[model samples]
Target chain A: MSSLVESTVQETSHAPAASVQSASLPRLGMAAPAFEAVTTHGKIRLSDFHGTWLVLFSHPADFTPVCTTEFLAFAAIAPELRKRNVELLGLSIDSTSSHIAWVRNIKEKFGIDIPFPIIADSNKEVATLYGMLMPGESKTETSRCVFVIDPVGIVRAMIYYPLTTGRNTDEILRLLDALQTTDKHKVATPANWKPGDKVIVPPPATMEDVEARLNAGYECTDWYFCKKSV
Target chain B: MACISSQGELSESARKMLAAMDASATPEDVASRTELPLFRVRAGLREMAEAGLVELNEEAYSPTQLGRSLLTP
Candidate 1:
């Protein structure tokens, strides 16, 4: 698998300059692209997280102010995510040694140990596969992007932030909670929905179903809109 | 709501503030006790308050039941 990734990277590296534009980003509901790469923790493959939810994120570079804060924030909520069986994997186009040094620096400066594997995509194989590199923004550095994959490896959600902004850790955790709740209960979450808040039931499929929903003992705003406790 | 139930869930600065704070402790008192910067203490207090672990009242911050519970084993 590593050899395959290397060959692909070599082929792309030698491609015509005109054909070297950024690849299209992966679409939701599609299988996440697989890869094997060196990480701060050692070698890892996408299949290693086959049966657990994964939060795969990319930062522009290590040792930057915004990225450092984002890493700390992510590390802060990691335990909460683990309670839901989600694992986090971070990536950037930096070397593994650099990643190790940066993680150590973060621990020293902030007194927080990052408890996740960080991929060192120096060759940009994984980044290219995930469309993490936005050439329009910076040809070398990856943009702030996140991909939430389910246990089955389906891309469930994606978020992108500009190079200048830091991400909200609360929003990321809330999104994971929302996705898990919807998957488990077959209900949709309303805007700004939190864990204990009422969830929106899917709209009925037929007139009879709608009529049944009206008397379903839930709080109904109308025939098609209803809220129920999970 | 998934309350932050343990110190591990908090950032390092927040945990420091949590350790230093007693009932009705002010941010300044926490900063002095924890030896953390004042801005960091204020930020940690805000995050703790958002997590339902602390409550702020008239320039004073106090840990809630959830906060105390987190301190316990």
Candidate 2:
């Protein structure tokens, strides 16, 4: 990864675009694909977000009604996300000027400033890297996708929603909370789990463990199921 | 250690430890919870103790009220 970063700095032609296009979408529990692009905030690299959990999401385009509503929703939760040590980065196949104008329009009309950076990926370099382009949806526009990246840069969670339907931002925040909770407690979240809810413990692996789990005082229906507050 | 939290003022490791910690967490317990190494957990506990974020009771450690405040918004 250091070599990739080094070559990216030393030469502009080292990472071939053809090779980039061939790469598959990043898998969960694997490192996220790296790229740098001009953003509304300024020139920035993916590495700039190292050491922090990042929500890297892409929309079909900016200034569209659905995308505008999503941006405002994301903006409303910016401070809460910051409290959890998470940073938001948005992307689309739009130019920097267009991104800036859209941001300004959002601010002027909605009276809400987007607190995060929006990557201006005009050349589709980044769009292809993350498999954001869905020809079934639109060749020129990116699909609405979200990648929840951990502090160590792994792609922990991914979600894709159709362009016509708006995304539920609360679920994004809930997913982040679940991921962080799992990391902090080594526990799994049950369906529709929320903060302060009892976390699911790992099931027993052997007979002795199973015997112990039953007598271990967790709220268990059987050796295979257990829940406890961390 | 860097004061990583603007509100808690605890270092990053300390905050991680406190967030994962219950009233009766051992160093190994917290190490697994935070996914931090035991050595770092021990060091972070010491930092927390020094800052009064946590207190040693019996063999387990618990957070002070001041520390609990940091865990909330």
Candidate 3:
């Protein structure tokens, strides 16, 4: 397959939140806000990620059991993320010392070092900016939230979970793949779309498209469900 | 409702809420406008402990002078 077709294939199989939006969120496909902060790796600018896809995430705290599990999952997949030319950045309201200590503990106990920078947001600036600090969960900590930004800094996707539940790593990677595929191929992934499945062709938004779709030799249960090659 | 007779600066979220606050807006309205969870909106209001930032009458949430400052442009 051509590189374009390969990227489309990658997108259909990737994460859950890619291209999805919650009803209350700011519209997707728009520029994400710029932020700079002190992370585990040191001070970094949002612009530093100018040429790569970014998975910017927030967790409530360090050392908590639920957060630890989620962190490890992401850490284990760090190589895969890097392979895809995507960078992962974590955030929390804890101080830098706390983040460092927690990472060390995870390494010693779990035998893994998180490869990405964990933002030590001492003053909750990043949390508040990302709308991660939900007071219902904890006033001083961020909730579990994820943002997927494209190479140009447009926020293509975001997902938030209640404090009681952890997020899925596979779902996120799947989303990143899906989004990049859509951008590259101008196609859409079907619900529960996985790799090798037929993609949803953008249905006719205008009258002419309806006829074009009909003539496209696609499987049409309905005009809206026209399935075509990716 | 907490009435704002004075003025002060607003936080980003609060400023967003103030623009949407009409006489009928409640905590839900503020939450929707700021894209904050309901409890977060409550906490943000409470965090605004500046004397008039949040006025609670019965169960409704309204801004005070300092709170309005955050919302009013």
Candidate 4:
């Protein structure tokens, strides 16, 4: 699946940007753009995270109040993500040294060590690739963006926040759990769903399925809308 | 404590390394025992140490009391 998407990207990379629709923010279900970057922990590539889920997020800049709180929130949930085989990678248009210093300062001030690797995108190469930079907002800073990529490198979900707002860490974790649960059980999550809650059963595809589902022993609001304990 | 709840949060590789570790075992010993690559063993050890489940002393690695409790039940 990813190979097909990569070939498509390769074919388009040579074209002039003005000639084609500017490759805007990657859409959901597309293969995540590949990149090699210098991070606070070490040099890493997208493929380095193969076979694990990745939450790739971008912040505006370092040492800011909102970004600091978001980082702390992300750090607080690092262990929970680790339990689910998800790795967090942060990005900003900052240098590696600046990133190191900011992270050190955060550790010292907050007593919370950020366990994730933060990409130093001073040149904006990674930011450009991910379409994290919103020129209308601020040319020099990345917008608050989150891309959740699955184990196979396909982007599954994304969210963007304006510069003035901070992200909700709980929503991010809930989304991750919902995606994983859907993938594992082939069920859809209802509104305000959380782990251990009943899940929505896939709607019936045919009349035969509808008939079978009517007596399938599920908690059925209707044949088309059923809930199950998955 | 967070560490106690985090006992169930170790990655598969880290858990394997923890299971393979004994008193005075090195990262190399863990790699050999678990048949994991050396780099993976090292990474697992680092994560385990950070989680407060393992300790390193005099070039050897061993499970901390917290880590032992994780294995108990």
Q: Is candidate 2 or candidate 3 better by TM-score?
A: 2
- The per-model lDDT (C-alpha) reads 0.79, 0.78, 0.71, 0.79
Model 2 C-alpha lDDT per residue in residues A130-190, reported as the tens digit of each score: 8889899899999999999876666789999888988999999999999999999899999
The TM-score of chain B in candidate 4 is 0.80
Task: List, in order, the clash count of every candidate structure.
Answer: 0, 0, 10, 0
Task: Name the 10 consecutive residues with the lowest summed lDDT in model 4 chain A.
Answer: A1-10
Pick the DockQ winner. 4
The sequence of per-residue lDDT tens digits that candidate 4 reaches over residues A18-116 is 123324556676667766666765555665565679999999999999999999999998889878878899999998778889999999998989988
- Name the regions of candidate 2 deviating beyond 4 angstroms: A1-22, B1-73
- Could you give the candidate ranking by lDDT, starting with the highest? 1, 4, 2, 3
lDDT of 3 at A206: 85
lDDT of model 4, residue A70: 98
Shift of residue A69 alpha carbon in model 1, Å: 0.2
Residue A193 CA error for candidate 4 (Å)?
0.3
**Each prediction's fraction of true contacts recovered:** 0.00, 0.00, 0.00, 0.00
**Distance from true location, Cα of A179 in model 2, Å:** 0.2
Tens-place lDDT per residue, model 1, A59-97, is 999999999999999999999998898889999999887
DockQ of model 3 vs. true complex:
0.01
